[model samples]
Target: MDLVLDAPERTRRIHRAAARFCAANGWAPLSEVPLPNGRRADILALLPDGSFRIIEVKSCARDFLTDRKWTEYRDFCDALLFAVDADFPQALLPEDVGLICAASMEDWALLRPPPAHPLAPARRRSMLLRYAMLAGLRASAAADPEAGLLARMALRLE
Candidate 1:
């Protein structure tokens, strides 16, 4: 039988499944936490030494395409892990980002470099931060372009 769920419900299931996985893996689950650079991440995790990592969870149909924001989420953290449903084809994910299948809270296969990723680590970090800032500005601009200009200026200063 095909069990169809709404988008929000699917996302909630994904989050819960990931939370269970984190707990099992000895990682502490944290709600929205501010990054060192002032950006807020969806989930912040603490390692044994107290280091941190960020996770961004997404839920879509088996054949659905990823939204553009996926790129922005990668920038705001040391590493990026995506929690997705198992039905989605893993091939759709980009190289360099970690992947976790949410149904069983299991670490799905990691996305490997198809033929070696060209961007250096430092360059990727910079790109992610810039993309995130632009994304935030774009959201603000949708409401009010003047506010977006101010937000963009403030982000640039930081």
Candidate 2:
């Protein structure tokens, strides 16, 4: 029998694997990052070169097809990548974007590199500021469980 994972689980697996791969490559990966364009990036990473890269995870064909807004993400990052399972169809992905294939939790590869279009200096500065702020906030939250619980409870809608 073939094993299969639900969409959310598969997306999480791909995200984790992508983070592992990115870390090994000297990038700090942050998931569920909000971009200025109002789209949530699956994984926004701080590159060693002081730039940013966004990796979008597609759990299935429908997931990729339904959300074609991935292009808008390029305005906020130096490069864009699509991270998907090993069995995902390569043809469906845009040729200009980079590709990531995650075979296992700790095993993955960047099959292609996206052509770099450097972000404008001013835009980069603004995006970097927001990224640092978000990272610091997340770190503090993780360090303080009581505050985290309180924040979640307070933010929850009735």
Candidate 3:
């Protein structure tokens, strides 16, 4: 009999594997971070000293070559990582970014650092908070018209 896995179950397995891998490697990984431009990262990991890394995980039958948004995501992060379970040509990944692959926690690769700029923990935190607030504002506007109006009014008062 052929075995098949559901989407949620497969996602859970992949996430669990990633969490274990990160923990074992002494990296802290956070999932589902909201970005200012309405882009959300699947995982944001912090090195021991609090350096930031963004990881994007994909598990689809289709190839990554056709994904336009993935390229855009690489631009937003300091370091870009593509995590997958199946074998896909690493040549598709840009030379600058890193590639990580595995079926379980045992097999994972840490890609090299992004092009030199600067690594600042405080600056990253500031950026993160700003992104969070912007996302919150968007959510508020979507959920409550009164809140959105009040927010704009308060901003004008300031």
Candidate 4:
């Protein structure tokens, strides 16, 4: 029997797999990260070597084809990768980007590794700070939702 998953379920699976992969590889991965260009990355991994990697999750052909902004993420990170379900057509994925086949959180494999293109020192520092702040906010929110809001407001005031 063939099994078909909807977009949201596919996305959740992809994210869970990406998160597991990142943790196992000693990288801290964040979801729905906002970039300075107003683009939000699906998964932004902070590598142990002080580099950043962005993973764009594609659930299906339509999701992959319709996104024109994925290229812009390259400017902000050292590597750009695409995470998709096992059933996704690998040939449809771009050759320039890396690929990961994720069937579930526990069953995912890296099909390709993206070439390293390190960001400039200044941009790297800026991105790192942004990542840190976002992570901190997330942690705070998890601890106390109201405190998290106040913390964000204070940061904005500064």
Candidate 5:
């Protein structure tokens, strides 16, 4: 019998596996990262060598088919990948993007490696700064849930 999980649950499982995979490969994975083009990536991984990878999680065929912003993410990272459940039809995914299949949070396998295209120096610098700032903000929020509100108030007072 095939087990089916809801979209949100499947996405959460994919993220957990992606995080573990990134850590094992010497990358720090950040979730829900805002991109310059006003897009938010599901997972953005920063490598030790200053490069980055973006992973978009697709829970099912409908999710993948309905998304039109995936193409825009290529300009923001050195590599791009799609994370999906094992039951997803992999053949439907783009050939250019990498593929990862995960049955659950503890089980994930890379089906294909993404082709690397290094970002321009200027873009890399800007993205690195953004990544650092976002990471810092997230850490702060974790410590103090009201940090965002406090920061906004401080900005207004300035």
Candidate 6:
């Protein structure tokens, strides 16, 4: 029997595997990053070479088909990819973008490499700053749950 996970479970599993893949590859992965363009990237990673890679997570076919915003993420990163499970239909994804397939909750592999679309200098600088601020903010909040409400009102860089 095929084990069909629910949307949330699938997403969580994909996120865990994607984060691990990023770390092992020397990339810092940030989840649910709100971009300046008002797009919340599923995984926005800061590559070791100072470039960025945005990974959009697709829990299932409906998730991928309904979301067309992934196209807009190209302007903010050096490469864009979709992170999906082994069951996801690979053909539904665009060939130009990269692909990450999760074999299990703890395993992920980058199946396809993305073409380079270098970000404009100004945009890169801006994204770097925003990424830093958000990462720091999240770290602070996690380190101090008592400051939850206070941290929420600290700043809005997005």
Best by TM-score: 4
Candidate 3 local lDDT, 39-115, one digit each (tens): 77777666675556666676644545556566555444566766666444555666666666657667655544344
> In order, what lDDT does every prediction score?
0.61, 0.87, 0.61, 0.89, 0.86, 0.89
* Clash pairs for candidate 3: none
Tens-digit lDDT track of model 2 for 77-107 = 9999999998788899999999999877988
lDDT minimum window of 10 residues, candidate 3 = 110-119
TM-score of every candidate: 0.57, 0.90, 0.62, 0.93, 0.90, 0.92
Specify the poorest-scoring 10-residue window by lDDT in model 4.
Answer: 149-158
Q: In model 5, where do residues sit more than 4 Å from their true spots? A: 1-3, 152-158
Q: List model 1 lDDT by residue over 1-158, tens digit each.
A: 96887888877777777777667778666645545455655565554544345666777644236355545544444566777777667677766777777764455333331122234567556645554565566767889989988886776522
What value of lDDT does candidate 2 attain over all alpha carbons? Answer: 0.87
Q: Name the better of 3 and 6 by lDDT.
A: 6
Q: After TM-score superposition, what is the CA distance of residue 85 in candidate 6 from its true location, in Å?
A: 0.7
RMSD of each: 8.9, 3.2, 6.6, 2.1, 3.0, 1.7
The pairs that clash in candidate 4 are: none
What's the CA error at residue 1 for candidate 2, in Å? Answer: 6.8
Model 3: residues with Cα > 4 Å off, grouped in runs: 6-8, 61-63, 74-76, 111-123, 128-158
